[model samples]
Target chain A: MPAHIKNWSRDDLLLVAIDEGSSVSATFTQNTFCAAPVTVAKEHIASGSVRALLVNAGNANAATGERGIADARACCRAVAASLGIESSEVLPFSTGVIGEHLPLQRLLDAIPQAADRLCSNGWGQAAKAIMTTDTAPKTATRELEVAGERVRIVGIAKGAGMIQPNMATMLAYVATDAAIEQSLLNDWVQEAVAASFNRISVDGDTSTNDACVLIATGASAPPSANPQDDDYARLKAAIIAVHIELAQAIVRDGEGATKFVTVQVTGAASSEEALKVAFEVGESPLVKTALYASDPNWGRLVMAVGNAGIEGLDTGGVNIYLDDVQVVEAGGRAAGYREELGEAVFSKPEFTITVDLGRGDSREHIWTCDFSHDYVTINAEYRT
Target chain B: MPAHIKNWSRDDLLLVAIDEGSSVSATFTQNTFCAAPVTVAKEHIASGSVRALLVNAGNANAATGERGIADARACCRAVAASLGIESSEVLPFSTGVIGEHLPLQRLLDAIPQAADRLCSNGWGQAAKAIMTTDTAPKTATRELEVAGERVRIVGIAKGAGMIQPNMATMLAYVATDAAIEQSLLNDWVQEAVAASFNRISVDGDTSTNDACVLIATGASAPPSANPQDDDYARLKAAIIAVHIELAQAIVRDGEGATKFVTVQVTGAASSEEALKVAFEVGESPLVKTALYASDPNWGRLVMAVGNAGIEGLDTGGVNIYLDDVQVVEAGGRAAGYREELGEAVFSKPEFTITVDLGRGDSREHIWTCDFSHDYVTINAEYRT
Candidate 1:
């Protein structure tokens, strides 16, 4: 029942529907030039209850002006007509090439068949169908007991590049069988995403069609509406765990990524400064290239730390570590640091670069991937 | 008579001397972890009249502690001993690998030899000697008439990577024969640098060894100490022209650079905002890679614009142009745009990306180069 919405040989369309009275919380891209589908989805998600989501890959319905909005609405209308729901009850999502319009007729004709073929076991297939540049599908699941009942949370995301998510990822659908209040779900989604998707960057680019949805189906749970309840805490932990897994998976499968890098900043004067230092190190092209080459180029690390624009940052007080190997101490090459030790650590596929600002106790960390030659090949040759 | 300083196979030391009354102005890196030579040079230049400059390649005495300051002073002392000038009259510069100590003995031994070999024709050789990863030497010259006297301005610079100078460039020395006052020369140097060195970026990394010095030897007649004189204007224009030429040459010879790009941001609410948008688009890895592949990826362009974080930026008013072809209009694909047109423009080795913010009347432009596989190869394999 999957349809080739963009006329590609592969299926590029997906549809997800939930039961009535389900609570949903979603976040969209902070990009001011968000896609048409994002515009439509934001409006529909505001209605408090949504029944379905229509996602199409290959042609991101972004920068298409009024016609793109109309196209998104038409697709939502077709999905609604087949599912016996109002158009506003459906949220729309699109990802892929930006600045292109959707093939309305192909999508319209396939909505009915997609609706008829919808099943609970289609989560795995849905993950594959939503991919654009992702080499593999990203999906995670968590199970917990809430109020003596089984609760399940499943999440699927698709993003390989243009991945520095501001508010959310390119496209993610997280559904939990546990019942939760709308307000709690909203707060949980924001917190979960902030600590997960927001802490990763592939190329430091924020996409125009990023969206993350959290759904509470209320199909198998003792509904708990109180924020102070133990059930709320349990469910929140489970959801955040799933989100983190998905976020890490995205980084692991990042486009042309050869290594997974964790940049941790400590001893900053403030949490904001720590995060700034961490991201400055994580997203630095020089640092990422060195990671790809498996080179222990600690000079670039110290340079990135200085470039973080920290006010009154005492260079004499900074220290950097490559995993357990102390590479830089007091802003210079550590006396005990050996080239072979640093090289051994950088040769790994995963490593952490810890920077102590020697300012205060604040700390933050972010995950990133190395810049590889294939990164150029994938992005440059990508027709989209 | 050039001598090896860092013990490289080739000569790595350079010396330049001027008359006793020469007026000198200089700018250093904004990086908090600036090199030891930068600190030493700051102190020396504060004495108002510098007689000589000592430059060494193959090692940046950066990230060194108090030892680096002592080493820099020792080198200055050697230069001053050979030239019979005070130690404070000699400015020192080091550029190459970061976080390494200088070979103080070799540098000291080379100072007398380098001073003995200093000549008017050493500019070209000095340009080549200062190079690290640069494929070619960067040198520019301009001649103009000031008060019916011919004045010559010549500059030499060396930087292939670790660019994005905040206040100055990575090692540039410009000398003019026209006489100018210290304060006027200082103001001219700042204005000239802001328009030249500060307007270009190769890797968006500000080096800790960045230094640019402007020297007026007071050798020619008609010493114009007044900023309002016609001679001052003529000399200033020539000096700025030479600075622009050297800056562009650095970008043209950027490490692994294949295409030269200019990003122009216009119609912003302020020059600062316009510059921010220009640098954001110019330095975006996605945009640079697309330029490398000759792919007309306007989607990435808009994404970069949105990522510039201009508060309340009206996307509908944004427009982007690839050379003469308007790729984006009103925040969307222009109605008259064609894929082939964009491809044609991108395939060129030199082109401009013009972003019209449509906000106010401010505008700014910057020069950059494409990020290619060689960029990764060069930086990743750099031993330093």
Candidate 2:
């Protein structure tokens, strides 16, 4: 539906109505100044049975104070009325320029149109409609046979900038046609999100409206949702796979991103320390720009590692590798390393940088993108 | 002295020799992979009677393992031989690309030339000689009357990228023509550096070769060096003022910088918390990009504050200002704020962003530069 909420040029409203008796679980941004919609959605999801999700792009109803909360509730009520469901069974989400009030009347007038257009194959359109700076729609699907029944999981996500998710992405929804209990669904969603959305960062900025929801429709009644069942394990793997693909798609479509890179850190004192080192290297602007230029600057890499503030980190015990090419050993330029070798790795569209701390048996990794001139151009001209 | 350490075209060596009784206090980078020169300098400065400083700008003797340390000590020995001082009394410093071996023979051949060129008026030339990616030299000076005697403080610094200093800048030298006790000078240097170099960040990457040294010539000894003395206070203020001027100049001349910004966080639970919020706002890429474009993006400002990870922060009580223009109040857009007002403020080459947490009485501030297209270009092509 073209609500003309942000402007008169684009379609920007999407509503997803789940089947009755579906179990829902979600995670929201850890930002203290979370958006009004996030607050309302959290309260509504407490009942554990969400029937629909209403998302509007172009104006994130955030930093708008008391009136913003009321506006989010009003939109949820409009969607619920159109779907013939209670208001408490609907969740509302908004994304776009923050610190703006929602266009209530315009959004309300389009709710029925959105409900009228909803269909089983609307996932692609929904992904595009919820995009702010995303260059393409992100959607992933996985299917498997469990207990002689076909189980399917589908996921969609939308984000470009402000892309460091503390607990969730800017906006994501994963649905599966397999019966699962609420308690188990909650644990599975957290585990899937941890291995997927939480491992990617386009920029280090976390948004005010990040949220990821998982719905178990129970339309395909699998044999069991118990932890000890093979069916449960198979379904969980499919869900995690779909979530990872959707998360990777968000990074691939990141605003002005030219290259996709993976930062892998190993042999740390703990997983937390390893993550700290990976993030420091992944998010360093100098390192990102070097990646963009394909310079293979190991100097900036070592500088980023030194800046990670790992306690009692022995610089002499650290080593680094670009894919399979060993660039650094014992914290210095490897004797056999050549500039051309590193350049070959960094010139690729996607590559991984691995750092070995040589301290313990812990590891972590994250995916990120290079910083380009176009990144500055897009963000500088975003609100204009 | 153009020793052709990095290349054949540039003059990149400097030497400073002080009077016999000069008291010196210094700080080194907290980076675990600190440069070989930093390690040697720390050991030498511990003697409390440093006689000379040797600085080379072309190649940072960092991440070269045991050979790097030996090369740094060799350079110090050469400088000491030329100055007719103990090698242990000479401190060595290097700045430029990291993870590279120093050109020991070339640097040794130039030691005599550097010593011959060391004049009292070479501060400006020394500043320019120590630059790597910096486009301009940074120097600051102050003169005051202490105990009816004229005293002077002079400072020079060089840094452009990889400049989020943990304890000091890439390289800084400060000297005073007053009598100062070693203990007093040590305390004063820490205090001055904390308020100056520690409060600025160009990028969030810290270097492996950061060092700051404070020297007292004791040439104009007409007053007491005790902290309780008025003369001591007067001289300390002058030294701090010079340090601040040099620090701000580094930000003003930050690589590819078009604007200089100050982020001030007030009403935090403690000074550390205030600094955490200040640096979060100061170094946020989205905020910096908006600043470069001269856009009035208050939403990014609020988002940065929320992402600061301040425990139990009440978002509703936060307030933000662009200079005197109230952009945000009570965690939302200010009732009377106009975009034009914020635009006017951000359009200036220098501006201040103030955030009040409304939780306590503590405050802190930091200086930063905007992220521009050239920042990416310069870092991408730096080694090339």
Candidate 3:
């Protein structure tokens, strides 16, 4: 079973029925190669009101030139006409193959059916419909009691390949029934994504389309507290919780992946260095293969960390741990180390590998999975 | 039936011999992750003159700390002591597997027995011994008439993976019976490599240990005219021809490769931009898959060129030709372009992909191969 529920897994499209009091915001890919759908979504989200969201599977509608833009707009108009709202009030999302024109006829025919079945409660279905090559839909929801009134935040995301966040490839939608301004929601979503989605990588390739949207429907009672108060903390926590879960799911479902790994770099001179160190370790094929073989080869790990282009990293001060087992310390393999210890540590389906630079307090984390034969097979025969 | 000759196809280590009058020049990987053998070879090559070269397969004595350094020096010393030459004159090269101590005892035991069988002219034998996972040994030889004396330049290289040239991966040794100054030879070899070996990539990974050495044994008389004169053109041509052939052999032997591809980018704003555009197109997975499946997907070619970070690349000015058939022009699919033309173009065992930026006079050429399922299988299962 998926982490949340079944209703979402069965739905073909997302329903249009969140409460009227919601404010919507989004951040899209900044690449010059931005896709047509991304161009459309950015324009719609700028209005700060999203009455309903219409997303579909099986086509990404990217790289199809002007026709792609026209098709995406047409889908939104159809959804709005069904909901009896202005076309600008609906947001559309797509995930799947790139450089193909949208099947506008099929999508337009499905929107009325989708909006008619739209339910505020079907976050799970919304997640599934936006999936492409994703082994499972990712959904996370957290309820927080802020100022003695319950507030809930739900998030869903889909990605597996072409996933290395120069903003990583994927769509993430987080909705809440709270009274919040569009500006605040936008800032929070970007901040959360920067900390979570932006930190992970599966492949180094960046996609033409990438987006994260957050909606606040004002279904929950308004807090008496200001945006700077503990009420904001509760809201931020829910958003971050969902973002982290969705990001982890992307890693778990990483193409040709069998083991989930986390690389943490601490005691760095700056957050940037920490991030560089973490990503270098996360993306190394040697390190990934070691993870697959369940071999805690710290030498390869040290080699990767050393190559990260970080200045002034005292190699001697580096200490590496695999799932709490101290495998390397002080620029060398730990004494009394044995392959059996490494093998035991790697035997887990999920584990953490930590590197302490012993420099300062700055730190960063990267989540990824091992590269297996399946990744190659998928890519080699993809076009065929 | 090999590109060069029949007698050159097969040999064992015992049949190879070192040239006594050899003047050797070599360049090693510049990465701080330099392997132990790289360090030792740098010292040997820096010693002014080297006569004999000793190499062992199945262990790349790299990243093994002090022990690796000691082992590499020991191998050279063992060969020197047996050959009755100073240890500094014996250059050692190693390949295969990194970050582990070499089994020097086993190698030491094998060298003397192999040395007894060395013959003065066994270029074919030297080529075969250096191979790792290569289906065939690579050797390119050219004979040119200079000043009425025939000079033979035979070059050989070995590589299948971890091949991106910071210098050169796999060992390439070219021995010529041409009498030339070490200074001029060094300049000639470096310039030739920049145009040949440096223009290809098997994978983006640069190995820890990589060395390419050229040893010129001044046995033939000097040219009757100054080398700066056009009279030496035939000799220079021979060197360049051998370099190109040896470099292409590495590409032909690229791991899991089924098709060899040449990407030509022309009419760019600068040479750097042309190279950037060429490499981007050559390295793209989408383009590689199209090559693998023999699919005429010109959109992927345009996408790669645009993503190259090259500025002012008027998409409309872009033109892509798969062989003689124009698939994309005027920034879109060519009017009346046919898929059958593309298929026919790709069906050839070797073909050129030309991208015209129509921006400036700059151009570049890059060689690559299709990424197949075997590439993943070979790499993923290599260690196991």
Candidate 4:
């Protein structure tokens, strides 16, 4: 179910809190050019304790040298001191234009006042402040019956471009009130992200400041069964579900994106080969432009697959389909292929391109969006 | 020099002749999904003695099954019968919309009449017949004084997209009247093409039918001195000069090309690494679009250089320049860098991007064109 809680232009009561005895796990971008906020947050997360998070939009605070790091730290100190907690307990994040120095005095001056305005009711506001170019703030909540205890799991994320998970530029924050161990939560979050965020590519660029943190406050009543029992399964499922929704939202809001295109490669000789072909097909400008124009140019797809560095993919074994319509089979055009039919398939706002390598059993599903004039316009004028 | 003659539209007889006295050498696409033209061309060129070339535009006889082979043979037979030569002497080339079967009957009917209309002086006409989406036909001629005798070299080519020199769908024909041995001519042509045709890219796609053939009639009088003297040097230079002009014309006519861009990477640890960084910079859409918009976004250049798989490259030692302006220096933005200055540099219709890796001394060069809306337009609706 989707909820509408828009309009956060003035209210700044967005404060994150874990009611005490909370467990936390997080992962950040692996890019060597990571931003100052990402560096500070990861160091704080290493202590496995995060009581609150402060985030803002309009300045990415990346590539600004040592001064940027000092700005992020000062922000966390201001927020923590106002809340009467140790400075290490507060985490801060920023998103927006990179390579510009942040206005630290303004952020430092604002956070103490923001902490005084903290309320759990401001989850909606927290979602808004983290948004950059996203047209809508993405939020997902799930209720899970875990060993007779109901657990409330919610998540929020924001991203538009410089996205290709390793970890991707997209940032996700997931919170739940279930009692779980930190090591187990860490393992679970990594698995969930692997199946979701790691599989999507917006423009094949990995950003320098991508971070996702999952915090469990353990405020809910303990499970009726053993902690190591099947009771953990329900909470894990809930977290994975929320992650999927957030991941999908990021793809839908991709920079200058108009259509969401899913690429599913199946029957590859190996998962490596399947991923190679899938990435090639997803990244090809020719295929993306055709997708933008709503043209079912399957030849571009075939060309990309052929160019992927696979040694012995049988062209005869390749099969391509736009949705359920078979466009290519048995190494060539389908018997009744029609341009108009493909055009109709492409005209839809969303579609799946399923390619059967027909080689083995491994498969991969990659999510991507079409290349549009808007994408070029956004990136071409990004710095400006 | 450029010339004009009649015989492009298939109807004047002036010095028409066909002979299988010249040997042929070619390299075909390595893609397993290669089209029928590639398969047949490999067979025909293997035996050498490929003197006659029968080229047509408007339909690429590829992926059309057995009928493709028969149509190619029929086209050659028609041309050979008209000129009273063996059909085996004629090697055929086709360019244009691929996968559509060649209308063999229409072509076969037209070839005999076209051969009857052929004229030795119809260079312009022959050039026009081989054009697909090219806005203009290209022709180049050079005369050199070799061994006290005048040697002439003439060449023509056509290409726009589906270009990646693993022999892109580039078609080039060169005719010379130099008294060189068939073996020496084949060696020289390969060497010339390596530096000319094989080094240019349009859209980074390898076409199904890319051919560069040289036919030497050995009509020039004997040399005044040794075969291995400056006389040979002069003739080779003339041949290479013509090849370079033809190759440049293809790049100039690249699909939706607005400005011709040359990327030169030097001072790498190895030529392999130099080429790696050169291609990485060349293929990056961010760099290409920035070049298209003439924005001089040097940050994207730095990112691309880092992403290129060259190890031990000191980011601090990296330097970049657009023509004469130092855009990036010492691993970061240069001092006194201003957006307006970069804008001024990119405003030109043509410019050079020079990158110094600060490793050992190695260099490589690549030619490309700016990506534009027209490029998308041409490729997206290409088949239609």
Candidate 3, clashing residue pairs?
A8-A124, A8-A125, A15-A118, A22-A216, A22-A217, A165-A168
Give residue B382's error in model 2 in angstroms.
Answer: 0.2
Best candidate, DockQ-wise?
2
Model 2 chain A weakest 10-residue run by lDDT: A223-232
- Worst 10-residue stretch by lDDT in candidate 1 chain A? A1-10
Residues A42-106, model 4: lDDT tens digits: 88877656887777666666655567788889888887888877778777776766556667766
Q: Tens-digit lDDT track for model 3 on A112-144? A: 766666554677766776676688989998988
Model 3 chain B, TM?
A: 0.93
Better of 2 and 4 by DockQ: 2
lDDT of 1 by residue, B1-384 (tens): 345655467767888887888889999998878889999999888866698988888888988888989999999999999999999999999888888788888788778888877788788888888887888888999888887788889999988788895966578899988888888888989999999999998988888888999998878766574667776776788899999889998899887899999999999999999999999898888898999999898988998898888999988899999999999999899989999999999999899999999999999999999988899888888884
Query: Over 4 Å off in model 1, which ranges?
Result: B1-7
Listed in order, each prediction's TM-score against the native is: 0.97, 0.98, 0.88, 0.85
Q: What digit string (tens of lDDT, one per residue) describes model 3 on residues B1-384?
A: 111111233232221345676667777664455677788888888886686777666666665666777888887887787778788887777776665567777667766766676676666767877776688889999887767777888998888776655567567887777876677778878877877787787765566677788767767766433577664666767787788888888888888788888999989899999988888788766577667778776656765776687755566577788888888765556766787999898877788999998889999998888766666566656655
B122: Cα error in model 3, Å: 2.1
lDDT for A96 (candidate 2):
89
Task: Report the candidate with higher TM-score, 2 versus 4.
Answer: 2
Measured against the true two-chain complex, the DockQ scores of the candidates, in the order shown, are 0.73, 0.84, 0.27, 0.29
DockQ of candidate 1 against the true complex: 0.73
True contacts kept of each: 0.60, 0.82, 0.13, 0.16
Per-residue error for A26 in candidate 2, Å, reads 0.5
Task: Show the colliding residue pairs in model 2.
Answer: none
Q: Which pairs clash in the backbone of model 1?
A: none
lDDT against true structure, model 3: 0.73
